[model samples]
Target: MAQNILINDLPLEIFIKILKEVDGVSLGKCRRVCKKWRDGIDGSDQIWHEVCRKEFKHSSEIAKRKAGNICRWYHIYKNLKMWIDITTFDKKVREFYKFSLHDKSHALDVDYGVLPLKDAKGVVFYDMSNLKYIPVAISETNCCKVTNNDHVSVILTKTGLYVQKCVDSNGVTEGFFKAENFVLSGEVIYFHNGTRAGELLLYRLSSQKKGPMSRPIFDTLAILPEGKFAVQLDVCERKNGPLIIASTFFEIILVEYDFFPHEQEPKCSFPVNKLTMYKRLLRLKDRLQSS
Candidate 1:
């Protein structure tokens, strides 16, 4: 049997078409074949944009058909975030953007391109091949809190609490968080610069006020530690309380406040980076980008 092995012989446009059929990983391999291939692929960002849309759109459909309600929707949305999350803000997010979600009956098999909605609020995922931004019904909200520390800005209407530099149009904070609850296996310290009388303040991210503020979720036994360090502990929390892991650094140390008659202080320590913390950050950024 004879197999054609002359791929590079094809025209540049044909080579691009070939590149389009492959994926990011495989494409990485393809680029390694020769300098020509590397230059050709590097010249185009359009391919990355196209493949990503298809992957996410299909994944979204798979999530919806999996059978679940809003919780399920959130579950799927979050699970598939790695393939669809875009952090670069449009600055003009208040503008409406065109989008279409899953509609099994009249499903759009667009293979061309999509246009960005002029007045888009949330992140716009325009299918460059079909001129449509696949839609996902999102509940959004935003609110601000004034404080002497860092000029706290928060927005939590219904979707979730966002604490960041500014408020999202949906009233969510543009700032990113680990989640409602997180656990700690390593040492963690709390900075007292903002705490009043050493009382850790807690803000319930919701549109409606349930009660009061300044409620402590859990006290920092050693207070907030400065610089970077590591510790160990066995920390856990329920879905309602995920042991917020947004530590001063990446690790959280639940210092043994009280020792059980038989229990000892936690020996588990949070991982510490000796150099080039950029690796830790870039890994996170990549995950967020894919989401």
Candidate 2:
């Protein structure tokens, strides 16, 4: 008969190798088995990275890019799991929040669990996790657009543009400019200059400092012909840099910006037909109705 071997008697390297084959839920249970197994599981970042890779698929790449060198694999896995639960309509997640808004209130944008709402009293950043609100001291009457990420919040109004650090409510950096539309991604801001037709500007915040003292300066990133106007703007973070998409009434333009050169030519443009435009409008209408 073969000799009976105990799990605790196994070497940590071999034990971790076995744990690698286990799913995240199973790994959590394994932690409860004993101190040795728990330490082995918790100490290895590779295991959590592999788990994230297996579960999140393509999203793992995006999350990794965002997290950078300070890789908190365990936290990343938990965050992704929470996102999955929220997106998949988990009953427990759904039942966590039950709040009503005013009839005139409008949701500006949502990032992570924070929802920025424009209502009778300026803007409020509502934390979905804790059910708390951080009221921003700004007038909503002229506020055209507002967006936030985990780090900062950017707001555009008729008179000017404003940026506030998410952690510090009093730390606001204000800039006076006329922008038709804008999108905030991380520390970068891409906006359409209303004064000049077909002109798009890129503003990058200084990483060394935060708050009112450090203001962002912009440079002209791209310019189209007089008739072509960018109506919609979006930015996606890539391994190298950012991929910007600007949509006009007739065409969609893609521009890639890297750190070294800071600017590059438009990668490509796709023309849009009337039917495609109509379909997009219809979808927007349906979304508004549902909301």
- Clashes (N, CA, C under 3 Å) per candidate: 52, 0
The TM-score leader among the candidates is 2
For candidate 2, what is the TM-score?
A: 0.39
Estimate candidate 1's alpha-carbon lDDT, on a 0 to 1 scale.
0.31
Candidate 2 Cα errors over 4 Å, as ranges: 1-26, 36-50, 58-105, 135-137, 149-151, 158-160, 165-183, 191-291
Task: Give the Cα error of residue 24 in candidate 2, in Å.
Answer: 3.4
Cα-based lDDT at residue 254, candidate 2: 50
**lDDT of each prediction vs. the true structure?**
0.31, 0.51
Tens-place lDDT per residue, model 1, 105-192, is 1111111111111111322223221123334211221111111111232222222233333221235323544333222111221221
Native-to-model Cα distance after best TM-score fit, residue 282 in candidate 1, in Å: 30
Report RMSD for candidate 1: 24.0
